[model samples]
Target: MKLINWWPPMLGTGISLKKVSKDMTTFEVIMKLRWYNRNLVGIHYGGSLYSMCDPWYMFILMANLGKGYVVMDKAAAIRYKKPGRGTLKCVFHISKSEIKEIRSEIDMIGKKDYTFTCEVMDEEGEVVTEVDKVVYVRKKDFDFEALEKEKEAGNTKIPG
Candidate 1:
């Protein structure tokens, strides 16, 4: 997690991972308005705002769904409500019931798209941007028994 928080892309954009729940159901990200990330008018850059929201939903869903499933970011949209002048933050959360619903949907349809929304808020708690993300999820095409055996044998790498 520390490694990811310091990943070059994130670091370059002045984004930091503040917290991640033990169950991976919740995540918080902070974006400091630094000179490097500021736009021509000295406010937060649009690209930085989008980058701040890029990975959280996919990451949370993947962790909650386990290695048996495949999760990918399918689409995204960001609506800039106002310019962010100072530090801004966003939180992403997936309830247990929602996780269960996603699983059930995938089970029924073999694949499903889940949409999640989050808001980037300024220091005053006013929304500066609204982001909508869609993720594609489905069970992997592989032998579950074989995958379990490999996992037990410590021969496979399960991504979080």
Candidate 2:
């Protein structure tokens, strides 16, 4: 939370993660409609709304799936349902059972693309944006121990 609060893109756009569950399966991000983050028409910028929804599912998957799997966002789509105003929030959550299902599917198929949908809402709880993210997960064939050693040696970076 401390490190991510300083993330440049989020900080620049006024988007901030408000809270995260202890297990990292649930979190909330919020953005207040400010001069810098508004669209020309005086609503939340599409990019900011989308940004609040991005990367979260992948982050959750990576946390739950361990080091033996690859998790990345494969694609995404966003729709502006209504003009957002004031403080807008997006709540991200995926159940443990759902994660287990995804793992089971990946174990059987070797890889899978899982799509999850979430909404960005206004203070009144009316949806302002709808986003569907496709996350890709696959088993890794490489040695996790070797990767860890390389990471400790400061010589390798893993891609999400």
Candidate 3:
């Protein structure tokens, strides 16, 4: 499914895409804390905090890169800076130059992997969570026929 469709699930969990630019390279998504989203201490649940961070950067990259390339959130490491009490917002931004630089690096290295960083900030504009995300990108020349066959045979699960 398209990435935009994910908005529903995010919203269902109190996350809202407040603003998405026309280019869709930068976006502001907010997650409000409801009673259900609170932990025993009545702060934002850690799992929900992590969940709110789940998709912004990857979506930004995909929308910026168009279609020839594929981007995935291969791995993520989040460092929570402080307790979240009120509403939370994560602003994700990817520029053309950044995307171009990534492409150039991949072209020079052939099929390989790369990583980028994104941050989720609180109302104070302080980073509440810092995320290090790794993305595995491969070129069309890379041998994938066998892998595709395996996927067709239900032996592999490729990231969408």
Candidate number achieving the greatest TM-score relative to the actual structure:
1
Residues 1-160 of candidate 1: C-alpha lDDT, one tens digit per residue? 6578778989999999999899889999999989899999999999999999998899988888888889999999999999998999999999989998888766544577788999999999999999999999988864567767878898866532
Predicted candidate 1: what Cα RMSD to the true structure?
8.6
Indicate whether candidate 1 or candidate 3 has the larger lDDT: 1
Model 3: lowest-lDDT 10 consecutive positions:
105-114
Model 2 segments beyond 4 Å from truth? 142-160
Count: clashes, candidate 1 = 0
Q: Give the residue spans of candidate 1 off by over 4 A.
A: 142-160
- In the range 74-138, model 2's lDDT, one tens digit per residue, is 99999989899999999889999999888876664467788999999899999999999999999
Which residue pairs clash within candidate 2? none
* Model 2 weakest 10-residue run by lDDT: 141-150
Q: What is the lDDT of residue 67 in candidate 2?
A: 95
